[model samples]
Target: GLLRIDHVGIAVADLDEAIDFYERTFGMRCVHRETNDEQQVREAMLAVGPEGGVVQLLAPTGPGSAIAKFLDRSGPGVQQVAYTVRDVTAAAAALRERGLRLLYDEPRRGTGGSLINFVHPKDAGGVLIELVQPAGA
Candidate 1:
């Protein structure tokens, strides 16, 4: 079952500039940042407010990167909506059972050492849905 919305992912041309804009405009506090080589992205997580919403900003590491492709196609906007799950494997299995296709055959590493998987956009009304199991869970 889904726990809550983990974060909303936004693809950006530059991570540092996006972080600064979020901080200055929305006052979102950046809580984590990392470069995921496998994912080929430089990402940052920002805390939205006192109630704990989060926004993830992602920038491409190279022209062949997924973020770069997304930027070329969509022009740098919302990329994905992530949901917190207790067990990503189980959630993926369940979604599969319902005939929804996943982007990965198995879970992969996500922000903050979390396990993650995605429901393919084609299977979910063109919205990329990410399932995240927190680091320690």
Candidate 2:
């Protein structure tokens, strides 16, 4: 089952610039940053408040990356919403059994060593949904 809100992802053209803007304007703290080669994204996780809300900033690694396509089609903006889950495999299986289409056949490596998978946007309204199983959780 889903545990809680993990992070809200936002697509950006410039990762460093967006990190600077969020930290400067919203006072959010950049808690983690990394690049996922397979996913073709460079991302940063920002802590929003004392309650532990997170906003993820995602930038494309190249022109052909998904983030780049998202930027071209929609401009920089909210890209996906994620939920933390105790067991991503189980959660994904449950969702699959319910007739939802998962983007990947198996969970893929996500931020901070976590396992993650996505539900097709077309299967869940127009919003991309990510299910995250936190590292060591």
Which residue pairs in candidate 1 have backbone atoms (N, alpha carbon, C) closer than 3 angstroms, thus clashing?
A: none
Clash pairs detected, candidate 2:
none
Model 1 segments beyond 4 Å from truth?
none
Candidate 2's residue-wise lDDT over 92-128, tens digit each?
A: 9999999999998889999999999999999999999
Model 1 residue 78 CA deviation in Å: 0.3
The per-model lDDT (C-alpha) reads 0.95, 0.95
Q: Tens-digit lDDT track for model 1 on 1-137?
A: 89999999999999999999999998889999999999999999999787879999999999999899999999999999999999999999999999999889989999989999999999999999999999999
